[model samples]
Target: MSHFIHQHRFPVLLFAIVVVVLAMTYIQPSGKAEAFHTKDELDYFALRSNMDLPIGGNGLFKASGECAGCHGFDEIGFASVDANGNDVNVVDDWRATMMANSARDPFWRAKVSHEIMVNPMHKAAIEDKCTSCHAPQGHYASKFMGESHYSISDMLLDPVAMDGVGCAACHQQSQDSIGLLFSGKLKYTTDVLYGPYDAPPPIFGSPMMAWVGFDAQYGPHVETGDFCAGCHTLVTETIDLNGVLTGNHFVEQATYHEWVNSIYVDDQSCQSCHLPRIEDDVVLSTGYSFLEGRSPYGLHYMVGGNTFILKLLKDNISELMLTANETHFDTVIARTRDLLQNHTLDMELTAEGIEADTARYRVRLFNKAGHKFPSGYPARLAFIEFVVTDAVGDTLFASGLLDEDYNIIDRDEDYEPHYDVINHPSKVQIYEMVMGDVNGDPTTVLLRAAFPIKDNRLTPVGFSTSHFAYDTTLIAGLALTDENFNHIDGVEGSGTDDVHYHIPLNGYDGPLNVSAKVYYQAVPRKWLDEMFDFESDEIDLFRDMFEGADHTPELINEASIVDFVTSVRQPRPTERLKAFPSPTSDGFITIEVPESDRMQVTMFDVSGRMLFNESMIVNRRFPFVVPDKAGVYLIRIESQRAVYTTRVVRQ
Candidate 1:
């Protein structure tokens, strides 16, 4: 019997395997039975199911609507209202901001689609990386559950993703390597929601956990600039035009690094200006009547200098599925306008009396923000519109004038260079960062960008070229050579720029009226040209929106001197002291002190380090051998009447 069984065992096993396979095919779950089924396919189904769940039902991220229940405006006045009864609700303020509508930003969507069209092979990588910040909740949630490549399709379908930078996205952020880790490298805790306030007593916290499935915990990092750095400091890989990796990276936006290099780093966080603290103690949660009114309440208006996109979002609210309405958007836009006009910059326009039939005026700009003025996206720019008119309102000279389509009329063929002096109407001073491709030509494609061709954006106070973060927030092109761009007496960190406008009087100098204005454009015409050239659904949609919308740039600041006449002034000996071969290639600079009785001259480097000091009576030109270093130097001359300082550049 044993010998018979051994011989028949092979046949029995084969028959059993066939029976089991047939049974499994007929009775098993249809998903498991499919031959081509992959883990991603299964996970996608699960992801869809989780996303479809009502609000807080999802195990990880909850829809922002869930938070709106407590944080939104309340008619009963129990929460979110200031002492003056102004409704400063968190959800209402945030909903209208670019941060809230980041996912719905038509320009960003169009740009992303444009990049994908240019580099089809990198579609997956681009979508995944972009959604990491824009649609973080959905992207991170899917990634958390082992799903790879969160695409735009996934973002559109997921309710959490469409919420943009929602409550959970920021509150659930884990305080781990925040400032150090950038470019959407964010970490999150599953069920812990962070806030600037300390953890509520168990009585309040328990309800929060019960209501939203998240424990409200104290997280000081939530109030830090480093927390925002996770997204603000973006460094992207450089790719060739043919979709090949260039083995280099570009600092796409360095808002965080720019702040770190400025004077405000020690005193202010990103929240200080954007969020705006309210001194009145105010209730944080609705229905918690016994809860003490919290002090230092920050309004959740996370606005930047992107009023153009905000207006676009407002106009197309229904199309974008925005939670905020038209009125909310208008309120936010007004706030943004105020921020750009009052907080961003300060300008002083002075008439440097007419000289040689050429009326000279100096426009000095001081950046007051924590970072560079017009920082963040490289496309943003602020240009000075200087105009001089005759007594009867005839145009004498005008630079930085825009065409009907909002494109700079006098913009250079490639890009405008930073100018210390503008003698002609064609030369305009535009504060912006221009990206260049491998060929050193300007390119709007982020992936193709190899380096910055021109980045003369106004730096913040205390911004130094020698700072550790200066490499990322560099002053490129002609601005690097302009001594007055961010320097005073060759000392860096002035956060100011002086543009001397030498407008020709043209024999008509009767009461010249001068007006100097600084205008900012987030979605500049030049930036739109490249993106519009691409044929895609996103691009088409954005083009339609842009064409229909008003293309007026926001007036950041303006100054005017009405009815001014050139007058002769008494000249001093110090004013006559001339420094020849200003940007000297040789080691020596000739100082011609015309009427010098006894004068002390001192020389300093860009860092304010003194190099030489000499006191001598010189009536004629003398060659003073300067340090042979190739950089900006400050030369100070002291006489009896005045002390004068001028910059000398060594080539």
Candidate 2:
């Protein structure tokens, strides 16, 4: 016996060490990180554990009906009252949001049909990608299990799939399950329900809890933008018009990453802006625990800048009537309008009377959003509408005007590459993302987009020009010429855009009222009707959505001023030597001479180091590669035509 014990000493010691480690892990005191850490919580060993959950099974999530019985105010047998004498419940507010009825959104349905009809081979990928967010609950449960139907009609036919993003869909997003920030790699489970706050007190005789059998757990992912990115930031395969693969993965949306790269990520979160917390003390339901306590229950309205869609849904009672209650539609609209009007952009207007019977008005638009203005879906567009009129309200010059049918009237008729310099009444400064096909021409078909022909959307604060190489390469000519297209020239790192409008006074000398408004449109009329076919059911259905609907652009932010022009200011001559690609890569620069045939080009480093001092005849565009490392450089051009000084950055 003594000999046996001595031989087994090492084995016994190993067992004791294993036991100690297990005990330490289980008995560790809960800290703030464990209680509310928003980043990924999965360790190396548990990283792939989420895949083991029943994401492909319908039984993995309790229907919203089951949870709403206790969490909702309008559910039968539930009696939760708020401070304002109204029935208060999570479902009551959330159900009416865009998140609740995402699948039922007419635009989504019509778009899915149109895409599939356009490219039959892309049917499965498009359906899977869209359903991953629209009807996440049903899509995950069925698509992952090979039980999904690619057809939009079939998916809409399923009641379980029509619920869109329900309570179970978000609560089941465990830190261990969510893989990556986007592409809908979210995993779900019914056994555990996760939330931002801790300690969801259980009701004494709550049958709903007993039926769900969910262990309430605190998970910070519920409040983090990474979780939202699981659905928001999207990428899809690009296909061309000839049904050929474009070999480029088009960035469909980058709202989440755009916000992540901005300065707002450090201080504010997606939930902070969208789902604002409301302090309240109310009975959650009958037989509730902790009946009266100050709890920061976030408002679940989930209001966004989609005023047109929300109004359309509200007016159409037959479409998802129960999801977004008609009674709460007005409140949601008001909230959405307020968010767009006051929160998105800050505008400042300054004007001076110019010579040649013209008024020069400078409009600066500062992007206040965490991401680019009109960040989501590429279809969204936002532009400045600058108008000047006389005291008698007689229109003098107006840009960015839309016809009665809501079609942009001031845009180039031939759809010339893009517009940066809008000097004439027929020209307008439009801020939008225009996708291009493999041929480098603008195309509206999302799947056929190989690159962005034009993306002049105002960049967020702290925009890194390096991140937009594709845009710089393709649209650099116009981008470099227009300050509004590239704010980096004047306010690098600061997401503010300035536009100087030179409107011809045309002999009008009286005080002119200068007005500027920023209008946001979800879908441009040209894009919507470009590929539209009245004979096709899908196209007809899409067109029907706008019938009798308020499809007009929503005014995001506006500024008006009375420019008392008593005198005229002379117009400055245009800069002679033009520079293409101001932010030079590989230390290369191009200088074009439109008027003079001879000029002197001088270059200086940031430390005032003289790099290049040479005289050359520039009859045409001159290209030079400076032999300097990556840094800021100053270039001066002196010619018989004009003298110009410009700052250039080398990378």
Candidate 3:
């Protein structure tokens, strides 16, 4: 019987494949038939014809809402306090995160639309590649089918596709499913829900488990970086405007691979930071059989450094109402800001002897992320803004200042690229990745990106220049190697970059206040504005969706070099100053200094977003202005010799 089955195995498999394809074709929503004119469609057909794996077989992958109904709060809600003391609900927190709204992010929509508009013939592939990660359940459940979800029709046809990285997506990941380079290569089974625990208590009779009907099993892969690599690392195949292959593949975002060679791999996984285990054991839902015995579960609050977009969504909740409620939005926003405050970057400033009235200052930036600083998404960029001021708060020198429209003042008029050292107002040290087309010309459109024009993103610890040597050969026109990006020349072993700035003091005194800020922008003005310039309906739609968003740069961290010596004429005073309305929501602040008249007051929000800095003449009472946001803020009042730091809360 076995021999007979083996002899006819190929034929049976082929028959099954044909049946599945036919069934899928028939089940496809009416008026949503795919057109075959594009190169992507042609490639799809060829691949389908020659594919060894089965296609179009519907799997048991479920939607995020389905899982939430069981694992999260229902009519009877549950809440927990976050680091910021905000009451956080599990469902609300997860829903507000980027993982849940991956399909609904406006920047992503704009980028994908721009890619499709520029490379019309490859739209099918672009959609598939992007949706593979964003809408994994929709794509994988359809058996590696093409174009899981792209438009309103997709959302209407398959709601599961719009769930973003849903519950089933992560739980279903199998060892054999992930590929070497992470771009949504995951195999799954409906009957099994893999987890980090070696032996998850038998949950068969649990109410939630019974509803889901999946056996909980110990899957060690869940705890490794390899699991996150299944989607975090993205690779895109390049296609020229004329529909011809560029013979190049862009390693668009290699966060997973970057971690593999980093020092954190041995001791930490992505979960250690992003999904840190909470010390307290908590029940997800009451009236459940397995609720009481469960140990501390990893916090489902997958917060990341995406404050800009999260805030945008919160402001436009009427239009983009993905979160559970207003409280949920506020919780996620606070959590996002808090996560951004984690060890992302460190800045140190040093000044040498003044020469020719020019102060030579050295600023060193250290990357604390496991991957490249500002990694993931080519549109993201990070830079340092150094400023110097005299005792009277007169700006002596400044670098990396943004114009009114939020464009970084670059030496190049168009701000095409940024440099490292900044000795002049025109220079900005932007750590970013710039892509080039097949002609070696810079382009932001994803499909035409054949090579990197320049990528000076800070490397992680233990980064090897040799591991990425193959990228040089893979690049069509460039003969460059990985040395340009990695700083592993047997000298600088890890992800640290040093930049020197020589500011012309121009007769400025010795007590010049020197301060530097490290800022990060997920989507820069150039990329965002260029996307809107395209004359495509899809692009316009996304542009409209992105209106009123905070596209300006965000302050990641800031540091100031304390002045050691003060001028003898204006001696420093040691007197503590107090600010009134400590927890005021009225946006009114007052600082009182009895001894000092000329004092520098600089205020920064908890996330290091600078409000303003000014030298004020303080008498008995001096009124100050602060941002209208509710949060804890740090107020620094500096005199010639002593500095006073105080915290104020805006209720």
Candidate 4:
């Protein structure tokens, strides 16, 4: 099972095996500098000019029995809304956003408690990089972290989570139900959650507040796409620099399983294409507007990679417009480049029947749909785009894009234009845990708090503090089995817990173009180049709002001229293809395509992992099967589509 995957840790898998099949027949043109991010004129909001450096607090919330008599409360009864009973007010969708500033920001509670006390179940075991936006569904189910029901006073009674983040996280719900969960049980078994307002008559709020049902079972898991892989998939685990679990592997976030085994989960779902309700006319938010209020139900907004922060958090050019087939940012890279051009694939190898480099076939590509087919925000990167031809089309055996300095692999910044990072290098640890408004000494929350201060979050003022002062270190009262956590067993058991992706599928000979692409950009920058900053909107809002600091100087965004790819054939590959009773103890196998050509029958193994793929059109003689797992496999066949592969051993 030769396997390879990359997310930029340096030269890895040669930039997707050499610049993606020469970027599939070229199509350049995308050039419109100075300020392109228009969902209808977005500017976002700038200041800088006399820009006084610090302000930080007041983004607001504190109240509840005002968050602990004033700035310290954390619960709203686990703050919820789901099971399709929907009026989802996890405190008005976390007011300013960042899930209500997730506990007054201090750089996201000291970079998620310094990546959970430096790892091993302290937290961060994989799930969409920082939990598909911080605890998206709060780990499958347990009614918000369970111990009966989590703490830190609902981060100050959900001051929208001090605007750091909180809106029942990704639209609330509970019952997930896959395996374990006895003792009392009812925590998850399947409920409905699409939050805020997942359309269906009843305009906004009040189909009993618009939706949020429980007790389990709800509409195709809220419309499928696998319920946004339980928080866009950013899991965690692996340890040992003394943390233990030497089995090995770290860095977690599957981007929703790389678009669920690729070829766009048959037909999209993260909201049928990013929050699309079809619209009888669009316009709901009726909490009152016409003048006095507004907000009947449409602003889950959720679209990430932060188009420079929605150009500036939405004024409303129809909410940053676009959807005529989603204009970039995350449709998992235009639905994985239209599922690699409508399932464009081909492969072959033949023995007893003929055609053979000694006959050897093996091709397997299944990125499913997000969950890792390039799910979300974690410095995006996925691999595969092999091409091989012969019988006439010429070419034979190819790899990915490029980079071992051969360059050519910069899909903006390696897909999803993100490049500019620091990621809490290490040293911060004010743990005991007490996100906002704490008075102190209830034994600990990292010892009563107060370091580098400045609060209120969710975009606007931002500020993040703390690397040590954890009030003498109560470390959330210790115990994770007394701090020695571990759990590693995946790739085959297909269970390391969550946030997954495997990546390994190579087998080709003719008319082959097995594909997978999800390159998105707008972040990577040690400095700045977005093709020479186009000039100014304060250098494109300091490179789209603080991406690589020093107030923002610019220069980053390459690709001036790159070409040298050829191999386009209507007919030219066919060394000889066949697949008969050879070794079909009955499971099925018979092929002969000609009526003008167009075939495709695949099966794989030898560690490439694609069980089957079909499309024979019906020329008269076609029978296929053998997929359960008997023994040596690998078979492919394609037509004018010119491709053929071989290898069929079973006994």
Candidate 5:
């Protein structure tokens, strides 16, 4: 009998394996059983398929598709419609946004691969933290099932993970310590779906629970900026090149903190702008005839500054395995472009009058957003494109010109410094943040970033350096010293920048036409140079897509003046005072005056500190010596007629 049992043991083991496989395959939800023949087969299918599977986890969260049946587009009841009777279903609008496709974003995939490639030792930590925000459903659900790490490979195989930032990722978030949880640390409830509205009647709520296995409850925290801060306020731990932790944390992104320091903190929230509210009454879900229309419906557009990625997704819908069609992407793209061009900023270009054969214009940019203009990712940037042309469209002076590849021409090798006055076309006024490594060298790698080498991005209105949150959103580089940057009369929180342009006429004093435009780039070429240098499958895929797409920067705002004549012959009182030997080596400068009345002369350092002030009587030449320091100094000459400010370089 013992010999017979041993001989049949192999057959019994094979039978047990078959039984386990059949149970795993057949024990899925009612509708998903037909999707796979075996557990191994399903994994193989998901690995190759570009489309996201309609599979929810056995843990806390469900895939976004589970909520689509009730909240998606409805032909009969016309649920989730706007004031114009147009369908504004939550699922449809969100399906095409960066938020919905966060996990599927090629750039993000490539960047994750790049980071892991740079620091191979910390691959587990990198993927765990990155997917916590980008692929929250998969990451957290794995954690719920006692898994320590959810890798990029695991995300690719799991349909729930590929759902990116699905409905459950936000709706299932717990109100406990939401805003206080920085980085990807988010707490989710076990079986609850939270919305802005109160608990629904059992008639609708019972069906929702049956369909998605979650009860509908009201969560006021969903509409708060602090709630969004869980992921938006990212603080990453610094790591050395060899993947060792440096014991220092870097504020990779502080968008929420930037908003807290602004005036909009009192009145506006993240949902107010991204998920715009509509006053029209509309039904929240379909298949329920007794459902009453709700007021102040929030559309889930989730619009942001990433039009470049949106276009890439639209162009390669089939390749990316995206659910949204071209038409859906077009709608989101149109709304995003509208938000960027019409609502992001306000620009005014005024001719301050030409002085001494040079055209003087002031370009003032007012940040209209709740946070910084180009907030969030460090790679995003905005720049001024100032052009002075003659009547025949002959370009006289042009700054911030882009080459064929959409790179700003003549940009500094490392990074451009913040400029109060741009006298040369090579000096472009770019509002961007540059990251520095442990050695104070410029770097694109986020893990190696020690601090912000330069962060001159435009601040929002009411931004103050003394605000509690300002340390995380502090302004860096020369912009800190720029008097006209976010300051008025030496007071902070103006939230505007005044860039003065002094273009040389070069003896051609014809009527000049000045055109100034603010251009924005989500992914500038300079930011990609380092990433493209490293070779990987994800990086190569994105490189092909990015290289094939149009690289033109979006025009945020523009202002133009036509047929402007300069009064060079009849110089103003302030224009008459000219300083000879501008770059004075000996610190002694002679100010040639027009023999005017007694004037008030003042000297100020770049930081707006008054260095010297005197009431002097100028006969013809008034000589004065600047400080011994070799730096740029502002000279202000005020007569009874007018006030003039000029910059002098002391060597």
Candidate 6:
């Protein structure tokens, strides 16, 4: 990469030589000390400074116990940065997580804490849209306090900023203040601070290159897609029509500018294929606590289609699901069924794209994705299905549905070829989907979550649809059928695995009798938890909807295709070691190795194993303490092949 950008151009021009080399070593003290430039300083000589502004996550979301001194509070999870022997915490993938209950998202902090008590001027614009992206590294203006809830370190009360986005709120960025994202435009590293160990920083950190949070990553409108468009590009103002503020508008919640006008933005960029670079692990993966000191690695708990938060962080629901008499395992995957298998429903009773005096007839279902066809996270849900037959194939017609605002809508509901988070979101959800009138009873109100939530737009597998209608006799025989399809989990597609029985060739042409196959499923998180009333039985919303009931409705109710490190997998990487430092820093990471080589040290997240160790080896560079409550981890130091990867920065 241009000799790694010309060996980081003179170590980032030495922060313009930190004002003449820290004022010629700032008043004498050369016992070999360096680094510390401003944006606010602190370094009792140099115990690793790292102070490139953001003012200590707004005082650790205004409660400063200094983020568990290394985030290990009440022992939550994810801190396996630098370890000697045993210390792992992704607290079983963040115990009961939604980023550890993003501080209880009851309709998004109870409608912005009730609009910060009847709107205190939109309470810092709803606490800056709920801390940029759930405390995008905490300090959300001292966790907002307007409602009063304390318990900092990963949020307990109104640390509105301490919700999910943690870790010194994004490796604490640099490069002249990462362009001050959000209200600004966007930027991840304008001056470059990427991670994975080039070491030294925190002795008043950043000399243009500050990310020791473990490298591999940015900048230039941050590689366009506007660095994920400052929280997927959105803006919302209130008190419109003469009320003054004039509804500031701006819209986008994740079309990411329709993938920046896509053709995959000419050649992809949102970190090319979603932060991919980990030189082949079937589909990118790495260790040493996420991209640490770089080696073509980047991924770590960054999966897509949200899998309903990876099914509450890995309850797996028995490897997503299966049945049809357990079809003798080997690997088939297709649980709860949503999208993948070619999407189906081609049609031809007359209208192909519909709209000319249609008695309900339209078809063109297609959805493709090497990744991001509603891939993961942003509330996934795919669509399309029109089965209207007549001559003996049975079934007259049918419309899709899953509603309660899960909206599948039917007419075979081809909700724009699928790929979502929002296209309607109950007419734009800012938070209020309770509508219904003709005496259906939802009282009133058309929409509100705050308005503008769903709009995923579609067209990934070539999404492009318009001109609709399918009154198809209201649902002919109703039975595309599915009890528990089969299996094929990892996901990729060509479409068509069974489920194709429509005889409506209303325009057939011989040999084109068309026969196809491709059906698979496993979905049984308790039969989709009966079918959702939702209240969390410790979150098994039928195992978080088979991580989106894959097989496709955009892999409905999704979660966990595993791999938050192999879906809670652990044990592998221990050079018979140890360390010890835990006034219980959350899960307490400190073990020491050298008691007779037979080592093992482990910690896993995304739901599975909690801690592990095979012991013996009392000393080799100890200082382990990471119970959890931060993020990004995976530390394996096996003695077998002599593994020794390192990357730690817990503060």
Best-matching candidate per lDDT: 5
TM-score for each of the candidates: 0.79, 0.73, 0.72, 0.23, 0.80, 0.25
Scanning candidate 4 in windows of ten residues, the lowest lDDT window is: 455-464
Scored by TM-score, the top model is: 5
TM-score preference between candidates 2 and 3, better one: 2
Candidate 6, position 343, lDDT: 32
Query: Which runs of model 3 end up more than 4 angstroms from their true locations?
Result: 1-59, 74-90, 144-152, 178-181, 198-200, 204-209, 321-323, 411-420, 468-490, 562-651
- Better-scoring candidate (lDDT), 1 or 4: 1
lDDT of model 6, residue 319: 39
Model with the higher TM-score, candidate 4 or 6 = 6
Pick by TM-score: 2 or 4, better one: 2
Please, what's the RMSD in Å of model 3? Answer: 14.5
lDDT of 6: 0.31
| Candidates' C-alpha lDDT | 0.81, 0.67, 0.64, 0.31, 0.83, 0.31
RMSD for each model, in Å, please?
18.6, 18.5, 14.5, 28.6, 15.5, 26.1
The clash count of every prediction, one per candidate, is: 0, 3, 0, 150, 0, 121
Tens-place lDDT per residue, model 3, 1-651, is 000001225446966996787556644467566643477756644532311211111245655544544455433333243344333345555776788778767667667778777777777777767777887766665554443434433532555666677677787787665435367766777677776555345543354455555676767777777788878877778877686887878877777877776778788888887877866545445445444434555777787677777776666655643534455567777776666655787655654445565677766666787877777787888878888887677888888888876777763643334443457876777777877878877778777787787777777766655665334212211212333233424344457666778877665565777898988887666777667778665566556655667666667788775443334235445456688888878879887765555666667778553455565665657787666778898887766556677788888
lDDT of 4 by residue, 449-539 (tens): 2221211001000101121211211112221221111111212211111111121122333333322222222233321232233433324
TM-score of 6: 0.25
Model 5: runs farther than 4 Å from truth?
Answer: 1-55, 199-203, 566-568, 571-651
